[model samples]
Target: MKKVRGIYIKNSAEIALMREANRIVSVVLDALGEAVAPGVPTMRFEEIAQDMCRQFGVQPAFQGYGGFPYALCCSVNEEVVHGFPSRERILREGDVVSFDMGVVYERFYGDSARTFAVGTVSDAARDLLDATRESLHRGIAQAQPGNNLYDVSRAVQEFVEARGYSVVRRFVGHGIGRKLHEKPEVPNFVPSGMAGPVLKPGMVLAIEPMVCAGTCEVEILEDKWTAVTKDRKLSAHFEHTVAVTHEGPVVLSVS
Candidate 1:
């Protein structure tokens, strides 16, 4: 297993494996995106993602990872993240679905997510999704050699809060490599101090921002995994596994 630290660059072989793992994750997300629509069972989409991983000779990282028991996190409106796939939750018009996926190839991992609209989503919902995605870019811009992790967090928090949205605090981004959710948890909003470690080149991190249309507070479902906004308002999440490089930040999970 790769050692977990605040910041470190990977070697060429590790980079190659990570690229392959991220590629599978990217393709699986694209497949999931195409299959999501009104009247479609969420589990069907999860099955599609699982099938794609099998076809690619990779394993869904979330499946059996800490007993998650699902290939993908199919979060519908108001659900922040970790929504288990179920046949009963058929997506309907105006519903927003967030698909968070990860894959493991050759013992390396990649993670990413995208929130999609079912059909004819409300303008407010559209703005929330757009803002959440934009916050991803805003956060990634801070992943540089000379910057600290809080820079990334501050970037995400400022952008979302300025738009009257709240960043979910319970489930933040994480460092991922040979294992998913490694050391040095990356928060979407900065903590109250300057103690966060500085980023360095070759550090692979999944920078995901979960933005809530209502309050920042969240609650876990009965399954003890899916996190939902306390006020039942819509939420959006976007993510990309990124590596800090001398040139800039490069997103590993590209589609």
Candidate 2:
């Protein structure tokens, strides 16, 4: 691998290692998604993620990274991102929970996130989830060679706004490879006067979109980790680690 203008370009070998790392992330997330229920404690998902990481012989990428204590980030309704998993936080009917997870294998990192409804939810909550998820795919579709990085950002922003939703500006997507977070901060909205870097082959990015049913502004809770919407309204998050290749964007974080 080599760094060009602060962005790391992966070789074919390195990309293969990263694929394995991301596959582990996908497997663990699938398990967590299946375990989401109305009565389960949020911490149970963390335990399941840790066990899967051990079974796959990989490391929990978030654990101890910047002092994060758990393997998964369980963001409940109104929580935007980085919510700590806890036994005290129980899943309830009509609540939407977002699970953000990552794993490391052979020194490469893979990251992904998904928001799941606890049970039957309000129609507004369901619409928010659908729009947020669709926006993620729209962003990923723009991850191709010769496209400006902001192309992906614009795609996400436009889609979310068209549906009457707001994108979380404070937390953006990022590059991922040997390190969990890399250069080329991938914002969901395009900032004025910034064109961003050109997409190129071998560039891997974790494209995540956190959408809010209310205002885009958010505040960190007393825990200093959980971020909640200012209006205490519904929020949803979706993510996928994608690779820019000769053939276009290939989603790496998939089973």
Candidate 3:
């Protein structure tokens, strides 16, 4: 590994290990997504995540991290992120849920998120999910060598706003590998007057775009971990672990 401007550039071997780590994340997310249904408790997803981690011989990265109690951040409806899973919080028809998951494999970390609709959702909710997912891909496309980090930020911001959604600013993405969060924070929106670091080969970034149908403003729930849209409107989130390579951006978290 090499550190340039405080950002760690992963070597070929490191990237390979990260690939396996992220692959596990993808598989787990697939299972979680498939399990979404009405009348199911959110805590069931956490149980599924733990079971999958064990079967894959990996460890749940979020469990106990920063005193977090659950393996999955199961944000429902207006909840933006860091949502706590509970048996009482059962899924209802037409609710949108976002599951942010992470895992540790051989000391490397993988992080990803996806929003799913429970049963049949409204047209507005469906649009939010589609736009959030596309925004993540747009940002990933900009993760190329010699490009400015803000380029990725700009892509996500513009694509999301153009679709009539607001990007959450309070919780941004970040570098991942060896640690859950690393140097050079990856914001969905570009900050004024900050160019950020130039993209380079071996740089791995967790590009997550959190979007809201209402205001971008966020409010923390009484639990202090769950983030909700201040206006109580719908929100969506999507993420992937991407690596900047000579050929272009490579998504490491795909199955």
After superposing candidate 1 on the true structure, give the runs of residues whose Cα lies further than 4 Å from its correct spot. 1-8
Ranking by TM-score: 3, 2, 1
Instruction: Candidate 3: list runs displaced more than 4 Å.
Output: none
Which ten-residue region of model 3 has the weakest summed lDDT? Answer: 193-202
Per-residue CA lDDT of candidate 3, range 77-189, in tens? 99999999999999999999999999999999999999999999999999999999999999999998999999999999999999888999999999989999998799999
Model 1 lDDT tens row, 108-199? 89899999999889999999999999999999999998798889999999999999999998889988887788767899998884578778
What TM-score against the true fold does each predicted structure earn?
A: 0.96, 0.99, 0.99
Lowest-sum lDDT 10-residue window in model 2 = 20-29
Give me the displacement of residue 199 in model 1, in angstroms.
1.1
Error of 3 at 87 (Å): 0.4
lDDT for 34 (candidate 1)? 86
Number of colliding residue pairs in model 3: 0
After TM-score superposition, what is the CA distance of residue 44 in candidate 3 from its true location, in Å?
0.5
Ranking of models by lDDT: 3, 2, 1
